[model samples]
Target: MLPRLNLRTSFQLAYRARFGWLATGSLVALLSTALLSAQFSGRQPATVALDTGLSVLRLLLSLVLVLMTQELLSREFDRRYFLNTLSYPHPRHSLLLGRFAAVAILTLGLLLLLAVALALLAWLIGQGYAQATPVALGSQYLVTIAFIGVDLLLLTAVASLLAVVASTPSFVLLGTFGFMLVARSFGAIVELLTRNTAVVTDAENYRSGIGLLGYLLPDLGALDVRMIALYGRMELLPADWPWLLLSCLVYTVGLLAMAVWALQRKHFA
Candidate 1:
């Protein structure tokens, strides 16, 4: 079923699949960030620019992931169109895997385009102000943006999984939104716990619970290195990039497998 998945057709469908709104949304986010940076009358224009740009990018991408997956999956399931598709010779897993690929490809393209636009906007804003610090266009900055793309990819996989298992679009949306918030804040939550010396009730157990959570949830904070780019602090990124990449890959694969399993057992009665 996986081998039979048509990549080209899926890519085309994804390109044409309600993508206009996503593109428009991304443009709005970009313009808003640029305008906010332009209006700021404070120190460190570069920091403000990068922070605003990245925050907008993350927000838009998160919406894209959740909404795209919900539309693609829920439209078929909710409307019972998936039954018609299953009437064909192809297996059910093909539909699930193919749609996921399509969404992933579309997401990657959107992320790259938005990242470039934001980078350019940041640069232009920096050039406009003589005293303001300009956003660095270094390799680290580009890499940081790439990491954000990876983060979106991981989140997309999770959203896809939820779309398959969830009963309705609203359920999928809420699950994905909650997952995004938890994943983004888990690192900070763990850090806060580590510093809370007042918790003298079984410190070892608390440490164990923190370690377990650290292993389970995605470390979205690790992928966020915008400060490194804004401040030209390359050392801020983890020393082992490969480890982070590996973790994301593992999580994506796990999510996809679960989505496929969920679809396999899904009844269309």
Candidate 2:
């Protein structure tokens, strides 16, 4: 029988499979340090070292989660292993759905673990820790996770689509990275453009509009919410949540549609 991946099963498999390997090793290592430091008393160590350590860990793992999603399609396509997936009785759409769902769940679990670890580390920081209301903390972390998810989903779409066209994982990774690195610099370009335009037009008027245009070129940096999450400024706006959710859904599904079309046309040698 084909796997019925609604919400629950998809999430469960994610945690059991990928999430554990990616997050657990790192978490455990950090936790071990925290435990060993229990007796040594110095606020600076936990505040600077522990807090920043866990934060960086979470960020890296989040990136890994996204990269892994891209590779899911890349590897199978590279090795001519799509046959195994096809043999299962599940359609390609269902398989893609399962892969996305599994990755989402893994990402989510890592988010939860990140929250708990950060929360504990913050509590231990004494004066360095800012007091946050429950709602504020929730909003901050939720946005962080959402930001990561949106970025990864977009990248996954690009990766899958690239594989469909390029037909090699190494080629796909290099091309995608090149395209993405160029796109990332657009924020600074937008800033420079804003400054120059202000002198010419007497306004920063369309600066944000230009920035919005950055969305088309793959704005993965936007998904990183650490600065906001830690600083307590950019909480998930009411509109932000729905926009990201909608964007991820549209991008992923649209790319997969393109992938399916490519696969149908592809002549496997």
Question: Who wins the lDDT comparison?
Answer: 1
- Candidate 2 segments exceeding 4 Å error: 5-19, 28-59, 127-136, 179-185, 196-215, 225-228, 234-249
**Candidate 2 backbone collisions, by pair:** none
Error of 2 at 84 (Å): 3.6
- Alpha-carbon local distance difference test for all models: 0.77, 0.58
Backbone clash pairs in model 2 (N, Cα, C under 3 Å; residues 3+ apart or in different chains), count: 0
**Pairs of residues at least 3 apart in sequence or in different chains that clash in candidate 1:** none
TM-score of each: 0.87, 0.64
Backbone clash count for every predicted candidate, in the order shown = 0, 0
Of the candidates shown, which would achieve the greatest TM-score relative to the real structure? Answer: 1
Mind giving the per-residue lDDT tens digits that candidate 1 earns over 123-205? 77677676434556789788898898888888888888888877788887888878888788877666766788466676656
lDDT of 2 by residue, 39-147 (tens): 3644334334443544455445545554555556566567776776567656666665566555555655665676577557655653343333211345665666566
Judge candidate 1 at residue 253 and give its lDDT.
91
What TM value does model 1 have? Answer: 0.87
